[model samples]
Target chain A: MNAPILWIAVPFLVGGGILFLLRERYAAWLGGGTAALLALIALVIPIDTALLLGPVSLKIAPSIQILGRSFELNTADGPLLAIIYGLAALWLFGTEASGTANRFVSLGLMIVALLTASIAVEPFLYAALLLEMAAMLVVPMLVPPDQKAGRGVVRFLIYQTFAMPFILFSGWMLAGVEASPGDLGTTIQAGVMLSLGFAFLFAIFPLYNWVPLLMEEASPYATGFLLWALPTFTTIFALDFLDRYTWLRTTPQLTNAIRFAGVFMVASGGIFASLQRHIGRILGYAAITEAGLLLLIIGLGSSEIINLTFLILIPRGLELVVWALAIAIIKGRIQSLRFADVQGLARSYPVAVSSLILAHLAMSGFPLLAGFPSRFALWQQIAEGSLALSFWVFLGMFGLLIAAIRTLAVFVMAKEDAKWEWNESWVQTIMLGLGVIGLFILGLFPQALQPFLSNLAPLFEHLGQ
Target chain B: MVTDTVSWIAVGLALITSTAILISRDWRVSLGALAVQYLAAFWLVTRHLPLAMGSVKLIAGWMVIATLGMTRLSLMNLEQQEEDAFFPRGQWFRIALMGIVVLVAAGSAPRIEAAIPGLGLPIIAGSLLLIGGGVAHLGITSDLLRVILGLLTMLAGFEILYAAVESAILVTGLLAAVNLGLGILGSYLLIAGSSPLENEDEL
Candidate 1:
């Protein structure tokens, strides 16, 4: 039994089946349940090892071949799988509340599965195709029935599709570079192509215009899932590239480029987010900013980069969920996600409003929230290197903080005659409340994640070394 | 590998038809030209892939054409005028731009071919023309159908180049799936983006 097929393909088949056969209401439960089960299996079932299940011995192999290619998920990938599926479950469970359960749950599962397959595919370049496939699936999700595909969706598709050729060509060139290590031209071309490919994939800076546009056009929940899934997987894929290529990791020029890109994205995303009137766009920018920070973490080229990346990522899922949920809830009540449209919403949906503010604050790295500890570490690291860069990053954080404050002010702008009421459903209340509490808990004690994250760096042996 | 005369003719026809698809005013003409381009591409791909696999590309392309045609019929009611321009005013500028793109692609193909040695000249030139032209179309047009067409064209170019480099059955199969998926999605978007009254009337 191949663990990858079980974890990746099985969920995809089930999810696709659910999309075809099941009713909308059952999607949340079924999708969430499947994801949870997969997470559990990933956590328990050791890859390339035998397990005695009451008298029957079962061996789950690491690699499975299909048409001469292989999909391998080793024991080192256990935590990563657990995390991916676990976060997937979190997103799936919330779909019912967000009112996008039907297709989001189904397509979300398939996207996650495909992304997992991308990671596990033997000829790493094949991952590019899988990523593109997963991205194409996002089109229908972003553009609803009877609606024209938005510029954001179109740009997103084009940009993602454009990445494929660059990556494939880079892979080809990299092989050439490997063959003749002294060839400077081949090396330069490969590096440029790889950078361009990742730029599109990560939606770094200029390519990220589609993000806020997509957030505005698509359902917040669906877009949030896209935001979470794509960046997380792409970062992992980037790490794989770094681990596999000694030249890519060791080059100071590439490291500096990564750092520069990170700082630019963070600074720009935050500044633009501060100027946004729509809550969805702000959250979109915040996701962009967070991605930039993650890139920064990786760019730092420290032994602890992998751990730091995961540390930032774990909290990000929660923050995005909270933010997206709040936005969706508000959107259900208001036709538009603009602050003006949602004015005085705090009086009606205090929990959602507070959740939104808290999530935004956490994203801005406010102390005693989930993002703070990671942000602090990153800041410390950067400050040690360049105080000027650290200050710029801080300015970005301040911009996000201002956005959070402005959002709070807008939400609380109620008429004197307005009455307080709890408009959120029980599910929304529970999810948002738990998410808010989780942020605080994780923030207060980030050590809780150390056990899981501690083992993750070793997965990339070269980088860890 | 030595290039045959028939292969060169097919490659030229493919490029010509691809250009025609971009320039044609009538949607029907564009669709016909697209099918021709696909057939040419099919012939070109046969140079690298087995006949069975190469046919997959042709079949997928034709299916996409059929899907797009059906979608166009369902969504828009174009007049039966033979000489109607797709874009009445911007033809000259588009033609000039396309010409420039073709020149650039033609100029760069040999250089690119030298850089990536195993790929043939025809494949290199065809891929470059299709990709460059398709991207230019994408940049120029905002119409959903045109954007989809541009995307498909770009993918076709990619398929041609990629098929030469990697001949894995699974990869070919997956690329075919992507092509068909894009067509289905493009069709859905076309119908969805149309006026509600038109959609209701069609239904």
Candidate 2:
């Protein structure tokens, strides 16, 4: 058995089959169960090594060559895959709750598998094509079944499509750099190509206009899933670029560029988020800030970069889930996400609003929440790196804090005589409650993720140094 | 001598066809221009790759055009089909952009050829024209069909250049699949967008 077949091909085909054959009622359970199972296997089974189970010996091959291209998954991938699929399972389990079960179940799994294949693909440049495929798959999931397509969706597709050529061409240029390392012109060209590719891919700062538009147009739940999923995988993809290329890792200017992008996104996303009256758009920008945090993790000294990156991703997944789920629930009750429209929403649906507020605070890295520890780490790094950058990061967090307060005031604008009601479905309540509790537990303890984060440190062989 | 002539012809064909796609008001004409642009791409791709492999670009690009055409046909009754304008919106600006693109391609092709050994200047220029034209198309319009057409042109342009650099069958096949996916998604968007919203303000 090979790792690529097990993790990439199997899930891909099964996800496709589920898309065509499975009933919607059965999809979340079956698909989520399959994902959870895959995550379990990844955690338990070691690749390219022998294992004796009862009476039989099994070895999972690390690499497989297909049509002159190789896809490899090594032992270090276990924790990473486990985290990815585990997160997929969490989101899938909520698919019905979010009313996106039909396509989300199937497409979500395929996207995960395709992203996994992207990282595994040799020539590695092929990862760009795979990433594009994953982005294409996201379109059907995002567009409303009966509603007309939104401008955000179209822009998303166009912008993502632009990234591939830059990346592929960059790969071709890098081959030249590999042959002659001293050629400054070739090096600069290749670096520019790569940075442009990532800039489009990450939708750095101003290019991320689609995020808020999409949030306004699409379901907060589905868009949330997208805002969570795409950037997470793309961040990993970016890190792989650093890990594979010695020149990329060794260059201080590149790392500084990454830090600049990180701070710029954080500060800009947060400030915009604070000023927005639409709750959905705020979530969108908060996610932008959070995505910036990931970039900041990458830009930090490489020793703990991998650990810190995965360490924060776990909380990010939770925050987005709670945030998206709360918005979805509230949106079910209300017509629009505008604060004016949802004034005194806490009186109507207390649990959903609280979850929304809590997730907002957590995303902004408020103390005693899931986001604090990671934000603290980043603060320390940025301080040591540059205080002006640190202040900008702080300003971003302050903006998110303002957004959180604004949201709170809107939610609690009801008269004192107004009564609190529990309108959220029991299931949604339980889910949100659990998600919120998970945040505090991870926030308060923070050690629960240590084992997984430690295991993930070795995933990128060169980045750890 | 024949190869050189075919290459230059392909470059000119790409430039004209891509510009037609940009300026044409009718979707049919734009799609037809895109079709001819693929033929030009195939001709240039064959300069480095085998006939069997290079034809993949032509076939894939044609299939994409067909898929989109069929989808547009399916939506014709539902959508209020647009007619040709005496002067289309942004027509002059598009022409100027294409002129600049042509000039840029003309200037850069030789330098790019020198920088990357084993690349032909004519093919580079042709590819750049397609990419530049597509980018201009994307920048100019927000219509669903036009956007897809523009993206396809851009991908075709990149594939022409990529074929010269990497000839692996898997990569070629994957790029073809990506083209088809984009086309299918475009068609889906067209059909989806054809259905009018209940209210103009509805999200």
Candidate 3:
């Protein structure tokens, strides 16, 4: 049996079938169960070897071909697959609580499958088209049947579509660059096209205007899923590019550019987040800040950067899940997500408000939360390299902290006569409560992730070396 | 591969139809022009791709136009039946801008050709016109239908140029899927945007 077909294709087929055969009430269980099962299978299957399970021995092939093209998922991909599918299950499990179970479970699973396929597809340039297809799938989820498609959705589609040709064209030029490494013009042209394509894909700096707009427009849970899925895969794809091209990795100028972009995003995202009055938009900017932190790790170009990047990323999925759940819960109670609209909501939905605050503080890199350990390592590395850069990064985190404090104040603003209550259902309370504990556990003992994240860099021949 | 004469004709038709789609105010007329533009793109793709794969481009394009057509037809109203000219108040400005873009594209064709060898002057010019016109359309309007048309036009241009560079079957298939998906999404947005429920909810 082929691993790519088993992991990617099977989940896709199951997701499509679930949309047709299953009722709305069963979506969360079936979808989450399917995702969990896939994650478990991915975790158990060994690449390049046979596995003994009870009475049976089975071997899974690494690659599957269709129409002369290939999709490959090898041994090195096991951890990545486990992380993706596990996070997907977490999101799917919360769909019922978020009130988006109907379409979210089905379409969300398919989107995850397509994105995983993008990472596995051979020639790698074909990944650009697959990414575009995945982005298009996000449209219906972002814009509900009853609501008009917002500017955020349109811009998201346009920017994603725009990245496709650039990346494809760059692939065409990159071949020329490889054949004629000494050709300056070819190298420059290829490098510019590649960076342009990635900038659009990553939504770097000014291009990231759509993130907050989308947060304000779409269901927070769905937007959170997009936030987690696209960038996580794209960053891996970017690392693959750097690993494959010696010229790109060795160029100091490229690394410097990455550093500047990272600093700009973190600094800008922080400043803007501090000024925002809307809770959803604040989370959007906070996401931008986290993305910048990941870029900063990539820019450091150190031996430990890959593990550090994954460390940053693992907590990110949980934080977003918790945060988006809180937002969705509050949104169901209030018409708007502005600070004013949610005033005194803490008096009603204490669990959701507490979850939102903890998640917000976690993203701000507060001590003993999921985000702190990675941020600490990142600061140590950056401080050792350049104190000014570290300062800017800290400033960005400070801005996020201020936003968190302001949000808390807003939620605390209730009439003296207002009585505290538990507005959340038992399910939401349990799920959110568990998420908060997970964040704290992961924060205190980050080494638990070491076994999974330690060897990921070796997948790329020269990436972290 | 297509002959020089066929290629030039296709390029010319592409330029005309894309312009018509941009300049036409009536949604039905714009979609009609878009179909013709797709046929022109298909002709261009045939020069680089096999007949079956090239036909996918044309079929996907028409499918998009048909999707939009059906959505518009479903929402037709007697009061909205009157034809309206796109950029009616800025006809001269739009015409002059188009003329300037054409001239600029014509001048830059050689430079672009030099930068990426083997792509002919016709392909370069046609792509430039489509891309330039599409960007202008996007900048000038926020209307859902118009924006969708602009995006489709830009994608067509990219496909034409990209076809000359890579002829992978999977790429072609994926691009076709993107086109169809865009159309369905555009149609859904157009219908949703026009719903009376939206206004009622807003109030």
Candidate 4:
């Protein structure tokens, strides 16, 4: 296999093998090593070139067919793969960073692999299987046998499993049409199914609790994988569907509907996040709300919006990593993440608190921070699209910003409790340092990213128009 | 015409099974009902394949696997004694009534006309039963595993509908693997020597 393909596939193959061999302990190390290697390869090698291995020729293109349907892996997929592999590496390393076992790493690798495959598989129905497989992998990682698996893992799986049929049906609906996304009937069915699948996959509205509940019950690292990988993949996959369905781009009504859904998700997510007492739950809400914003950007069906959407995912993905680590720190120290429980934590470890604040700020789209530029660009798109709708969207954006500010006030600025002592580890300091640098790098020099962002412009324009 | 009748019967059976899962309090019956639903789904799918020896072999092999899997699951259940609490009879009756309405509506949908001839009504009814049972399970159950099982049943129904539309064997096989993997994972979490339920009260 070519290096990029290997980067995607080897982790699952090796890590799964290790899981069976070493069962749990060495599986983490093996999986982690594979992930690190994959991340390295992702950074070094572009996703190009077909691999000729024995009888099989593995191709990398805009799309590929596995059994009967076609799946595309395009130039636009570079950043997404990078993010998945990068997160996989971080998650693997995270297992060792804490004293947790390796199951999470193994499962993480498996899910990432499945996600990569989902992006490349032809005839999109295979993506449904990949998604369900991702859920299956998540179950063992989330709840250990010694502890009763929370209803949340099952619930998460249930929700995820439900998305497949819709995706499959949609793909099948597309089968009779010409392969291009230009066919109107095929495009319409594909768009609707993709929308329904995404709505279910993302767990919007009545189905939304799984994210929070899973975060509440799962290991922080597993939660990181769930937030970072699954939704990220699903969002990209949804975008890919949009890419394939020309009808979605042609239908102004569809785009408008999507935009409305996005704003609604952001508003509802922010409102819920602000209401949540548990820090992890708060993170969950914030993540989902951010997802809403990204989707809203996607809904605009504009090159400017899509480019910003991709840009935002990078910083946001990293910010989630930092936030998850921050929660892990809090959990490690105090064993609870409730507001009252983490009260006065700032006085003891200013480094951790500062890092948390940066993460929170990035999440909120604070001015001169990682999230600000993309959020600003996104707003421009919204405002230009429709003033009336833009007014409401801006209001929702501010609401989220206020939620972030409140989290900062409550968690980072609060007086330290007299009883709690700080560990003040160098690891915490290093993580904090990275978070600061990351925020500044993306925030101050948005133009520095223009070359990379512009390179992706064509794909978005293709998708948007 | 014969295939069409068989498809409808299978669909009706699935709808009945879904109702059985919804109203019946016993987990055992639900499992039985779910297995039957899967078999019905499997039967409906078999009718979709091209009428050739290869397709017949493929269908037969899957049926055998289904039968074996069901047998194993049944035996495992027989080994466990705790009974699940039943839903109220009124709720079951209401759900059944609603299911019938959904069945009729799906049967009457304009899309039904375009469906692959033998697969239409069964696929539609099976899908309704599946989604209805799943929603009902989620609405009614507090127990985590049972709810998951209900969701699985729901997925099974949806898969049947999709398979009827297009039997991309690889995708279907992958889906089966996922289902089997999920079941194994769930079972491992629930019954593998140590159960999360052991300390349920403490939690």
Worst 10-residue lDDT window for candidate 2 chain A reads A94-103
DockQ agreement of candidate 1 with the native complex:
0.45
| Candidate 2: residue A27 lDDT (0-100) | 85
DockQ of 2: 0.54
DockQ metric, candidate 4: 0.43
Q: For model 3, how does the per-residue alpha-carbon lDDT over B164-184 read when each residue is reduced to its tens digit? A: 888888888889999999899
lDDT of candidate 1 over A255-328, digit per residue (tens): 99999999998999899989999999999999999999989987888877887899899999999998898888
Runs with alpha carbons beyond 4 Å of true place in candidate 3: B77-88, B193-203
Best by DockQ: 2
**lDDT for each of the candidates?**
0.86, 0.87, 0.86, 0.67
Q: TM-scores, in order shown?
A: 0.96, 0.96, 0.96, 0.84
Give the DockQ-based CAPRI class for model 2: medium
> In candidate 2 chain B, where is summed lDDT lowest over 10 consecutive residues?
B78-87
Q: Which pairs clash in the backbone of model 3?
A: none
* DockQ for every prediction shown: 0.45, 0.54, 0.49, 0.43
Error of 3 at A180 (Å): 1.3
Off by over 4 Å in 1: B1-3, B77-86, B193-203
Task: Residues A69-168, candidate 2: write the lDDT tens digits.
Answer: 9999999888888988988887887876765656788888899899999989988888999999999999988885466788999899998999999999
lDDT of 1: 0.86
Tell me which of candidates 1 and 3 scores higher on DockQ.
Answer: 3
* TM-score of chain B as predicted in candidate 2: 0.91
What's the C-alpha lDDT at position A463 in model 1? Answer: 87
